[model samples]
Target: MTETAATNEQISATLVLPYLNHAVRMYEQKYASRADIDAAMRFGCGYPKGPLTVLDELGLDTVHDQLAARYAETGDNLHKPADLLTALVGEGRTGKSDGRGFYTYANGEVIADDETPSADDQPQLRHDIKKVGVVGTGTMASGIVQVFAQAGYDVVFVGRGEDKIAGVIGGITKGLDKLIEKGRSDEATKEAVLGRLTGATTREALADVDIVVEAIAEDLDLKLELFRDFDRIIKQGAILATTTSSLPITQLADATSRPESVIGMHFFNPATVMKLVEVVTAPATGADVNETTLALCAKVGKVAVSCADRSGFIVNALLFPYLNDACLLAESGVELSVIDDAIKAEAGFPMGPFQLLDVVGNDVSLAIQKELFAEFKEPGFAPAASLEKVVADGHLGRKTKKGFHDYS
Candidate 1:
């Protein structure tokens, strides 16, 4: 049947009306699955979910009316609706109700299956972790200590000296206090978290912990020595994990007799805030070790992705190349602000390369770039001579307050 002039006129009011209407029609006609429709919407338009899902959440008539208004204004083909959406709107068969329109709703409510796990299903892993041990007194170590302590696990924070251990504990306490002040946590929670931490001045303090995470200075030899010592001290069957970002997990595993127990649990910077935890598995790492590490990440409210024991792993492997490219741009003597502005505007980056370098610390970026260049020997990964010069000048980003831009 041909559409009425009124229907055609109504189509002129919406911007994305035609696209959404087409999707609805296709879905109703059983042309594709809801998953495919959702995928198309998310990937095609960058909407968080499909039109149908959005309709269900926003109420169908609301979206339909909004589209109709946009169509009235634009008079573009994009505003026209597919036959399916027209029919559903005409019949008042909006989604999440009346058993119609992309999805069925029971008793005027969106039906949710309790038996099956949904996309957001986060199944908790039962970790029998009573005590946790962490080696290192730097930012990463303090963050690790916070994670365990907050989870009600007794944490043994180890450092080479009493002063370092004291500093780590102090940092952890300050972090917890910040959380409480921000209302993200309560005073009682802060107390409990602080009560769980025990700073140790030696490796022997890790003996009783169920899991030991090495977060020491990123020196391969130093890490290997620490792992060997941990092998002799930590209880057998206990999980041995590392927070090395670039080092190979297999080489670290070789430092211990029980290589099967060793794995890399690389936490991103400002570990307490970043959600990603790359669970690096070595050739010698046992299946149980992998599972336990994944479980531990979940316990700490992190999303873990398992990867092979390669330098830089997934995110960094992709991330650093882009960063290196940015450095190259800066090396061309493009004003720092110009380079930053162009990339931020054109590429939609959150921060310009130089700005991000400052935030990440120039020294850290130089070290990582050196490691990447050594491994790949690619021109793209080459450390920008400009960056090296800046670091040598002691302009080590935000920490030094004088990197790409002067903080002072």
Candidate 2:
């Protein structure tokens, strides 16, 4: 049982072990790149390093023996070591200290490029999209618009009226100004980027764009309505994508005649900073559609991992459950900072669960947990009682300027 004075080993076994096991099994199955898996954990969970890298650093042989001992003691299937990990250990390629494990290492440092997939290994190309249409005037829409325009794609964004449209543009400009102040950009580059953006208020304006991404409200009906409208409005042969974090892609695709053309491109918060984007595929999504979505992500400089259109995709699937458990610990009388500090200092996460919950919006976290519980029906996924109270209190997050912690 978890206790107030839990040691690092206890914390690691409880908080980090399940994720490590999942990562190893997934990597063995070739679900994604070793690089992508590590990158996903880092970008998705705010971890200092990915699980594979952590294994390599800790020494695969040590991890193998640890699992072996635990499995022998408890006979729990979850404690079983992954075949790949065990096989590597059998080869004596323990980890970085000895030069190899999941990654190649020399002089105790990982040769990162050794694990990077090469250009020749790239995914198939689909459409050569030159223009992108962004639906909505909110933070996500603006950030996505900036990302496309900054990547030299002509961007057309939709808003309700002149003022709302202006506000979106204004937000983008303010961000550009920040870049200029930091010497990361200049007036000339900002002007060129701004020149590539065309703001409109109607669906007709989006017709010619090769890729149209809907980034509006999270409501399913609203998304369905927008998808139906785009099905008729967006040009034939264009790729239709959604920025949805949790909804099913097939549900949206059902509204369109070209189910094969629909996909999900979930960009993380402040899309410009986060390096990972989940490239989700419904069963009906065409092979070329998947290829093009990955291609588009590469073009815009985002690391994309393709996954089934399941709840939480890859990163969120592994991350949110851990965050939920942390909440349960907090509600059971563990000091908030203790859990946060143990996670950050002992477990190597960048933020405590509480801090992350505050940033992620306790409401958003609860919604995702609810979706996870419904999808998997796992008891561990049931939303924390305290988290439910926080959301019910109406402190959504930084959006509402309060949540687990009061915003200053």
Candidate 3:
């Protein structure tokens, strides 16, 4: 191999080690099935392959040894190879080379094995939710409103003012009009969806909806206050959910009178397009509530993966740390473009870490990194100084037209 190509491979392998370790940790914790975990990264983040699939290609034995060495060198628990990885290596499920690892392979490719339990295996969906009340009018909330309305549920969306509410409806209409122009939808479908939507300015209007989903900001105090209001105004058995990407769900659940009814339905940005929904269950969340939430995800045409109420749920928890590490790698004197190019070329990631950080906004990235660090107390999870410096300089990525790279 050329010197540059060999260097790219080395950087790619170093970058993937922590990410693969976290995937194994998530698996051992039963956050989601192997298939679902793979699907989440693929569908949610647009990864060419899931972490486990990449692990399989790398060989379980090789990764275990690398991780063991890294852990010994750094003395960080995050680098310690997961027990699952060790056990797999011990059993000789080395990787695709041996036709086994995190998955079975045949003819030099995965054999399409699915371990996700079918709906039939789950407890029967307990709630009958015909109406969904969404409390926000931002991009995420608007997308969620459109999703539920298109799925035939009456969606009551509340905003701070009539202008924000009008803006949301107008944006949805424009999107549908574009789809109509492209032959993907028609005027009739648009009208039908619009007819199911109700815009309001107050939380009291959501009193009768079967479920209320708040797609508001990530401020803990704001969300807690909203949950308290939801408890008082909403009907007895209606479910209360949050679309928080990082804050603990159990704390939000505790703010409500019916903690059992509060769960998390974390949808990715552009909720209308993304398919993965992390169905987070708090400690007090009932089994029926989780099943009902999973059923709701299916009804809305989303793939639901269950995870415990934690700092980052599944996707963000696994995603941000890798991004943070990339920042550290850059601090170690590697060019940002080089690291980005190497990861994209060698690992099939849709965006390199710096590119993704810019797109996500460095400020938001720093905040999420802080949440992960605070939750796990892992030294490796700390937000990189490079990321913090950019945010502090007000170069919050694409929005500010400057970050690690100048967008202007």
Clash tally, candidates in order = 8, 0, 0
Clashing residue pairs in candidate 1 (N, C-alpha, C atoms within 3 angstroms): 12-71, 12-72, 13-69, 13-70, 13-71, 13-72, 14-70, 14-71
List candidate 3 stretches off by more than 4 Å.
Answer: 1-6, 69-76, 105-119, 122-124
Better of 1 and 2 by lDDT: 2
* Candidate 1 lDDT tens digits, 1-408: 122221222322211234355456556655444544554334322345565766665566766777667567756333445566667778877767445555666786656544323866443443366788998888888888887787778999888788987888788778878877888888888888888888888789889888899998888999888889988999888888999988878988998999998988988767777766777889999887787787777787776766677656654543455566556545544456766665555434466668888988888888888887787565546787888888999999999889989998
Cα lDDT listed for each candidate: 0.70, 0.84, 0.89
For model 2, give the 10-residue run with minimal summed lDDT.
1-10
List residue ranges in candidate 2 displaced over 4 A. Answer: 1-4, 28-30, 64-100, 104-116, 400-402
- Candidate 1 vs candidate 2, TM-score winner: 2
TM-score of each: 0.68, 0.88, 0.94
lDDT of 3: 0.89
Write candidate 2's Cα lDDT for 208-300 as tens digits. Answer: 999998899899999999999999999999999998999888999999999999999999878877878889889999999899999889889
Write the residue-wise lDDT of candidate 3 on 281-348 in tens digits: 99999898998998889888988888888787778888999999888878877888999999999988
